[model samples]
Target chain A: MLDQAFEALKTYDWGTDVAVLAPIDEAVVATSGDSASREQLERRLAAVLAEDVSRDAKDYVCRKLMAIGTAASVPALAALLPSAELSHMARFALERIPAPEAGQALREALASVAGSQKVGVVTSLAGRGENESVAALARLVGDGDPAVARAAVIGLGRIRTPEAARALESAKPADPQAKLEAIDARLACAEALLAAGKKAEALAVYKPLAGPQQPKHVRLGATRGMLAASGKKAD
Target chain B: MGGQHQPTRRRFLQTAGAAAAAPYVITSAALGQGAIPPASERIVMGGIGIGNQGQWDQEAFLGRPDVQYVALCDVRQSVREKYKAKVDERYQNRDCQTYNDYRELLAREDIDAVHVATPDHWHAIQVVEACRQGKDVYCQKPETRTLREGPLLIEAARRFARVVSGGSQRVLEDYTELVNKCWSGELGPIKWINVNVGPLSQLCNLPAEETPADIDWDLWLGPAPWAPYNALRCSGSFATTGGSWRSYVDYSGGGMTDWGAHHFGGATFAVDVREKQPVEIEYIADPQGDHLAFHYDNGVILYHNRPKTENLAVEGTPGQQREAKPVPVYKGEGGIYGDFIHCVKTRERPFRDIELAVNTIAVSHLGTIAYNLRRSLKWDAAAQTFTGDEEANRYLDRARREPWVL
Candidate 1:
């Protein structure tokens, strides 16, 4: 039944009856306890991604990989990262693969993809909280594209390490909108730092943003962050 | 600071008093015309996702004399126009604005609060963004789509000091009888409770259809994976079966979360464990059937779909009675809606505060993961992770599709 499902998958496209793929779903549930079976299923599903299947078929495989894919499946998913039609789903799996190789695949794609695709890769790296991508994300914080630069800014905010915070502080996005996003991201980084008990680091970020030159809301957030970090409450 | 800032009524009054020597004209509109409260006294509001429940929420807010509904947002052009027309009609003018994007509406400096009734996938993002924008939120349940989203939602609300109310009236009203019985202490020392809610969401492969011009399909599928535009795949119907987004894994947790939000919310509140998440989930597969026993730190267990146990069933020691305590109820005049508006005005926590709401949904999400893995698991609530189970831990959250981050 699994083999039949795989065969059917090669021709699967949007609008097709999804019931033909029920055997794959059953296999996902059935092999939960059987490591050998689960690994075999993962390999088979990964192989389908490299096949001449419709985008829908590969999407199905990626969804399954998201559940059970291992390091061995990372290469196949990574191969699709440069394809705009397939990059999002590929990251969808790679982002949650629990394997370092998956994060590396996304980082490598940073140099290979562009526009919204690159933005997607940046987001996945941030979503995984991959400390390794901090430098690459920092470099993109002032990218020519406002969307990419803004995504990189928010990505660093999510990364939230002291290094990421520093990168955010130094980022100089030429776009007005990106500059605003930088402030929001900086405040977010401070909150994250404060939550992690890095009081001094959090205060360093907050104190600067809380200055009179900042917007009322930005100053408000920074003030609140400073109060919380200093074990005080805002009245 | 870059945009125009609208001072609150209190701030306005303070400034006005300080400038008493200056000549100023107070129009009837500023003092509030006829039946409506003054502009300074009313809560300026906006509605996101004005579909079935969104419309109902809007109507409730419109009915409040203290609320000034000013904006409506929906991805569907038809829905946006229809609701905007309705709001304009209610105000006897064309003052209400409409937007296809929620971000644009959230950018308005004059809007004080928003009620978000978007699909489950958009809930956390919208709520968190609203918090960042300094707007109080009344978000519809289930408050989160994943276990990881629960904490982020709560953190955003707390970090911004925003009043966020969960949109589950059933948690208090529908289960009042059971809640009263438990709080009354008639059945002393409750040991366990059963909440039978089931049939997890499934994968969707609905065939491609012509994308309707009325809706921005990509925005509708925000954060979720790209699927072809099919009416049934995005239907807002109550069904957890194949017809609606509720039935799809990408958009919802099926009935396990859709109705689970209400059922488990009621069950946990009834059992007085509304503030806690189960520390462990034991998946049992007997010859009779498969069920789950969720163990709380306090020795209370929440059973999910245990065979022969009815929904919201509580097992307690009958002979020994415990001390009765006053049941918690909504604070303001109206039900959940009024409670939220009142809290927004008073800076108090609403009845279904975001933290409690997140905890209620956590039960459903944990149970769903347990069933998906088909095994028992230990949850470290503080860490919000599975104990030593990497495979199970991977399910904590999924990678959201491009351009959307929480």
Candidate 2:
């Protein structure tokens, strides 16, 4: 039944009988009962992505994969990451799939893909909170493409770890615009620390940026963050 | 700190020095983000339903140093012109765009967010679409006119990952103090809650009137059941506080939803209800009486009517309890506008998130049905249905006019 629905997805239009895809839902639910069923469901969807078909079919399959895909499915989805057209849908599945290999696939793509596709892959890794890619992102933080560097900073912000902050604090961008995002990620790291009740750690992230030698704007933000961390209202 | 990507000191100094002279120095960076512009770069915004409350909101957004009103929209051309001229003169730019259709303003990718002060019936659709477009939304109080619309709007925000702050500004510390106090459990099992927002409305029966030229009557009735134009029922005046639409079941649920959005939006934050709906409701339709009451599974009951306190309060078995003093909004930042703007930059949840706002409004819609039937209704909160009451369940959503989709 799930295979029939997968075949039907190739020609499914927006207003098609929504029930025709009920098998896809049943397969997704069926996976939750055990790891074997989950692997089978994920493999079925991953196989669909490797087929020659419309982008819509891949998107439909990715939607199912988001709920059930695993490490076994990452390689098939990863192969599509170099395709500008299919990478987004691939990332959509990869972003929600909880597997270290999925993160590694995204990290490997950083040194390979270029332009917005690379930026988007960086964003996907960021969305996954991939701490292993911090060094790679720190390198991309210096990418010639300002948009990609900016995307890398946003990626670092989502990571919310001491290492991500260390890289963000040190890396300088060619684009003045990207520096603002680097500063933003630094603060995000502080905020996450503060939220976890690590006031001292949060203050460490704020104090240097709040220093008199820092840029006035950065100083102002860091000062506010420092005060807020120390139990004073800055807003 | 870098191999080849370091920006020159001269470039950094130029941008930083330029920012020193911009208006409202460092106002939006409380979250450490918005833009890197010299003090002057503004968050672009659009105002929909610029009549009374909408006009006031338009002015509020314009008043910020960090916000630029690129467009203004209202269903009535007269009101649109009135507010557009005000915005144009204030910005000293005559090119401020005006639109009769909100979808037009929403189409502009330059807009960072929208202030949706449309009528209650139009609130859910506009906010949902705006969020779906990746634009942050500030929707007015009584965020939804029906229960079914609530989940869809919430789903849109969730799927799009956009900020949606309900415009019930009164849920601030002025009201939260009491709810926060009660949630601490010092109130001792809160025997009863008197919300007292005022009365509920039944069917609207205003006499029909000729449609005015400046107003687009059909657009105003979007998604709502068809009704002939009536001056008292469908005018710019209805956008003001205590307007005719508030008394119409088709357009609104009267004061029941109006103050319920304010009181109930903050009630959960105060009380220990956490996040859940009332399991039952009883509605009575006397103009001067307690119009409705909702029963929670926790055995705490809430009543609606005009109350004496300026803020939300509750009754214990022995006495009344509230905060020693209120958490006052800082002088310049005193309303939902500041909170919404802050959330836009920080991506933190606003004071009144619309999903929670809808949860409160759904209770009021339950009240509206109870009043219409004049009977007690048992509700299954999980299923979102009435037990064996088909007629009552039908009131969860209304029939739409042709071509107007939910």
Candidate 3:
């Protein structure tokens, strides 16, 4: 049955781009068909996850497992999350499943890595937009590394859950760059609230930014948003 | 009857005897002829442009019994006579057709496939025209002269569902295993790839020799800008194939496009970077001034001109018996012919897919653009246009002369 899936992908009308990708992806999809049962899925995942394959094959496996989206494979995907060698596709797949167990696994994974990988994971988790994920991102705003903390704060604004906005309000900026980023994060938070259909609250968030001290473009954008929120035109 | 039935189980065996006799079985007429007919269908072969490379190609195809040499075409009578004599002597049959024009040769109903060794400029038109007429093609390397020619050739082949194979076949060896090995991430994520090949420069810098009476200088120039015949450019008598080929801007992309098309095809396949174009390119002339390197979005650096220090060492671990001799970095030989036959049977893409050809042409054109502008440039893959540059687009596709437009 797994072989059939592999064959289908090979013969699939993937156009030229996907056809080039089929061979590696076929193998990963084939592995997923090992068994629908959680026990068998775990066993197959253990064997299929190899750090040594070509980057193409690794990416293929990541996409395939992510597409499966079974809670059963979450443990296996989570296990790989801690490894710095894990591909972004694999990390994103884990984020997509978004089970409480998966979120906890991702938090643990983020705690273990350093540098860009950590930033990537934190950003990915926040992008999931889970309230738990937003809170974690907000906490990262105080991380010792200012770049990471700034990324975390930006990620929180992107997440835009109510919990995230509250965390951002209370968090301290580490430097001038961080201060500028906080303003951007606040703007993002306001926009995300508007997108979420909280028109009154979105206007309230934007009203405070109508000041000369702010970047000219940001101040103008804030005033424009406030007027649009109140159902009036701004020149 | 059912009182005492013993279980019968099928057992598999690998017999050394049968293994040893496998070759003999294939060679045996009775068994072989029963399963597959001997001389079942003749592969009718035609040759166009019987220049030095074209003549050599004829001999290669003629060496096979399956290929029936039906037609030979060239602008020169001497070339026609030379191949006709060789074919007649070998086959002991004088029923072969000869023509001075390739269009006449392509028009024949009997020819199944054509071997096109025409000049760089004529490749696209001849190949596309042949495929449109339902003829499979074996075109010589560089596949096209410019970016504009690649898609036309690819579209023509695909529309006709014809088997059109490039002349460079090295990429298909062991399925480009070594190249794939590099992409497989074993080479520590390729920091650089240096091609020992570069452009075929024009030999017109030398004093012009008189045009030979027998050569069709006009046809030889074909779509290239017309000029009085220089013996050095037309016959290539004074230039080494590499030196002459690399120098010519009109006929070739210096070795960069010619050999780069073949080698870079493998590099892209191995790297799994077939889709994205190189985001940025900067050409560096050597202090002694021998070569150039093309950098890519994926951090892969491809150098052509002179060999670089990084590409000199072998890539992987030594074999069991000895320290690993450097695996050869590139393969250059009868790559075009060997792979064409394989694709014909297997119905699979030859190592250089048409898409790769298109992308490689786009990449190769960068060098020409750089040389002409005498500066580095940024390529925008999304816009399919160079950023902040209108002058560069002019060189991307050259205007075909009268009577030829793609």
Q: TM-score: which candidate is best?
A: 1
Ranking of models by DockQ: 1, 2, 3
**What is the Å distance of residue B383 in model 2 from its true position?**
2.6
Q: Which docking band does candidate 2 fall into? A: incorrect
lDDT of 1 at B198: 69
DockQ of each: 0.55, 0.02, 0.01
Residue A72 of model 1 has an lDDT of: 98
Which ranges of candidate 2 are over 4 A from the true structure? A1-235, B1-41, B173-177, B180-186, B236-243, B266-269, B282-292, B305-313, B317-334
* Tens digits of lDDT, candidate 1, B141-206: 988999989988887777667899999999999999999999999889889999888689988888
Q: Tens-digit lDDT track for model 3 on A139-233?
A: 78888877668778766765666677777886578464456456556766776677688888777768776666553334655787777677776
Clashing pairs in 2: B179-B270, B180-B270, B196-B305
DockQ: the better of candidates 1 and 2: 1
Candidate 1 residues A1-235, lDDT tens each?
8888988997899877888898998899899879999999998899998888899998888988988998999999999988878888998899899999999989988888988888899989988898899999999977887788888998897788888999997787765445656776787788878889999999998898788765555677788899989899765
- Provide interface RMSD per model, one decimal: 2.4, 17.2, 33.2
**What DockQ does candidate 3 have relative to the true complex?**
0.01
